[model samples]
Target chain A: MKEMFYNRPKPLHIKGRVYKFGDNINTDIIYPGKYLSITTEREEMARHCFETVYPEFLKIAEPGDIIVAGRNFGCGSSREQAATCLKYFGISAVVAESFARIFYRNAINLGLTVVIAPGISKKLEHNDIIEVDLKMGIIISKKNREELKTIRLPSSVLEILSAGGLVPYLRKKLGVEQ
Target chain B: MPTIAEKILARAAKRDQVKTNEIVMAKVDVAMSHENADVVIRAFKEIGLKKVWDPERIVIIFDHRIPAESEKSAATHKRIREFVKTQNIKYFYDMREGICHQVLAEFGHCRPGEILVGTDSHTTTHGAFGTFAAGIGGTEMAGVWSTGEIWFKVPESMKITVHGKFKEFISAKDLILFIIGQLGSDGADYMAVEFHGSTISEMTIASRMVLSNLSMEMGAKVAFILPDEKTISFVRERTKKEFTAVLPDRDAQYARSLDVDAASLRSQIACPHAVDNVKKVREVSGLKINQALIGSCTNGRLEDLKVAASIIEGKNVHPDVRLLIIPASRRIYLDATKAGYIETLVKAGGLVLNPGCGPCLGAHQGLLAAGERCIATTNRNFQGRMGSSDAEVYLASPATVAFSAIKGEITEPC
Candidate 1:
């Protein structure tokens, strides 16, 4: 019942099997609103990730597995846990055709990886291993050896991610020494 | 050369000018958190700060799942209460208040051209007041609380121009639903949307709120309606804060310009599973409903309730249906009660609940059973939103919800 990621360093290399989902996958499905107050702990939130839909997701998904989905990946309500839960549930990165405004920022701010690839959901199958290189701007599918399309993140976003999230980025910018 | 958004962000960033997609650190005017305040508190502490950078600027509200439906939430609420007390955060509202957006408006916390950030997606509701508002994560909000600032990427603006008067019973809700249907959910992703034209100018506070509150459904970063005399009056009526009206430059560049003719729109319904899956009322009428909800930040204002009362005046709710009416805030509750809207609803067999977000997020209150269907005035009808995954929710206007409550089916408001 201890916190999970408080002391751990952020992961830099993201390569994992694809966990495929369809379009318009919302925050409710990502993290049910019912448990919003159950616990603020990220690990507790991970337990309820996709609790109703795909209830067995936590058991099926391995640490560092990638998630690929269709458009509007995290729509509905601005629950930050919607992105945090997936990251804590062991999803190394989420690659979607697009992300809802709030969810995209939350994922990037939390240092959880997210990529916009126009049609990665259709091109990639569930459990297909893939490597993500934001600098190289491509997700190479290991199974098919095909190069997937991905927009290289802008420098502003990269600056935040490099510092490992908005919290640490601010800590540095504000000159708050550890 | 700057649009309304560019102007607002530049002001917040303390710069003379800012352009589209430029990242800038903006000072926080208001930092708000509701049920997620506990999450923010946790993140704030993790940021190694025992004190919020600015106490008076922080607002905490206990709206979602209020009265502690679970032991965990009860403890969480206690922790938040302690944090609010110790942090000396003055603008704290307990379960007795209402939904965060409604409470903020009622207390006159959001002002035009001021930058505001909150923990709820519907924080965009403040955009109705012309505030440059957006929703962010708990950790990011904690950062704002600690540093009293947050970064924003100045979004290009999307202008939606509306004209013509609405037909009877075809309110702002229908017009917004129609607009959402025309442009899919991600239509305005990462953009600032500004409502314009004669139709928007003539709308009251509540109607404009419906347009701004639901703008998030189309993936907007923030939303706005230029502050006018009506906005000034509305804000002055609630608080003494002097307001600023932000006008878009004469040649404000809009990434896209879409027009909506309000006169030709119908009673629109966003069907089950997606908010943009909209259709005309006649297209999906007669679908039986197990419940009818008429409240939420989207349509829980006194004006919204008056329309519901008029529709069901002197009439009994259908025996097969359970109608739940909730006001958006305690002020609206008292106003509606004095106006006899609550009495009329109760006399008509509709159950009047406390002023809070009841069953809208499916966290607590009136949740539907498996295979049940509900027609509601609240926004968003995603699957499993109101309890059972098999249960379906249809989103419509308050008039439509009241009519459906009386008919036990999805009937057109007209």
Candidate 2:
């Protein structure tokens, strides 16, 4: 049988430039509630994803950019839009010291790579090219050629990311009868 | 053995009990979104998720920063509209719909014996209907979008039983504030609170929502009301969907149970910085106010607005106070307007804003300036929560807030 959503046999991989931030990067700042009325397209959202925290975010973000931040990233409301906005804007993954529970689940379910890399916020700089091996919990900056930083991931989460997210994984695991 | 929350989570994961810090996949019965739908849609594209797991279970509301308050907000709205169309997700409410929590309950998205996760902290409001609802972050919400499942840590249960009848001047808001004062901000961190007793049974669903909504301020993961007849009737009226009848077992265990005598309770206030810094209204009686706001997912219901209107009726707000009134939703706004409560509020020198999260989140409308003092009917008055970090917020019942607006100081209604 084909592997279901986010149910890859191996861990997922993410390579992107880093966008570092502090703790408590709330939903309001990520995708400010005020902008909900505008277009829902990824392009439009990508333009404004981090417009508040950093005005030049969209211009600087590459297709596979990653966000590295302090503890409690995505600390406000359960708006999936905060994670979605980052994804919409081409953020391949978010590596934070910690994440608000709901945001962590949303990112994973949506298939946006999310990892907890304690102290990554301090070592990474804006636009730093980094590669993450989800199964191995390893992050390496090709530009710096420094020793790889390792972050731990549970086997269960690795399975989900490998399957490409929940829906596909469930379809494979539970069968797509419905 | 596991608690109800743990039991439900285990069933979702097809497990017996989920240990702490173990990531277990489970389904999200409901996923609510405000103006930030665009971001979520974007995440879907980046992750290459095909579609929302269940579009019908998705409720997208436009509450915070309504009326396209700015060019940036207008862009956000456009993104949400596009996503809604693309996903073919139903249950979309525009800016006029009202706060997401109120609309979710009124429209019947929340029901008993289910786990509902929202993208807002006040999603706990759904507990009034006996559903296990909690807030999550956007990334977590994205996971719910793709798989419809999320993880949870089994929380220890704290049972709070409020018995007896509430005095005329004491409302549910005061009752919760009083509890917070006793428990402190981190009092119930990572715990589930079960509100029981005669008073809870006697209170209306709207009143119960006020209590549950503020549970987040106490750092609780979930605040729940045991299913009763009121819960049954509420669900029956809202949807034709079936729900499992959920109630605590006779021999169920609890971490602790505290009995609160409501009849002897007084109107209470939670001072600035911490919700646990609570005091009786009379204790802080003469403190002047720069603003008084009555609305939020917590206390912004028709019943709450009616109570506030009654207090401020035929009375002018204090010259020093800027009184603001925001209805919980469009339905509530219409009901209040039809009942002449809007006129009463306007006549009392109050400004009525559109039905949205608005001042409650300090995003738009009625945000206080530095060193300003505000008495609000909303939940949580933590430092820097409303506007400036120095701005002080005093939480109170709607009536008490309205009366304070009239007196320009925190005061109990006569």
The candidate scoring highest on TM-score is 1
Tell me the deviation in Å of residue A103 in model 1.
Answer: 1.1
TM-score of 2: 0.76
Calculate DockQ per candidate and list them: 0.63, 0.22
| Model 1 spans with C-alpha error above 4 angstroms | A1-9, A175-177
In terms of lDDT, which candidate is strongest? 1
| Residue-level lDDT tens digits of model 2 in A75-101 | 545655566677666678899877765
Instruction: Estimate the TM-score of every prediction.
Output: 0.97, 0.76
C-alpha lDDT of all candidate models, in order: 0.88, 0.77
Lowest lDDT block of 10, candidate 1 chain A: A1-10
Tens-place lDDT per residue, model 2, B1-414, is 455666666666788666544556677788987765655565454445567789998889988778867887887788788888888889899887898999999898998878888767878788778788888755456657877877676677889989998888688998998898888665676677889898999989899998889887666778888778888998899999998856766666778778899999988988875567898888889998999999988888899889988888888999999998989999999999999999999998999988887776667787778889999998766455577656889988998998899999888877
Error of 1 at B52 (Å): 1.0
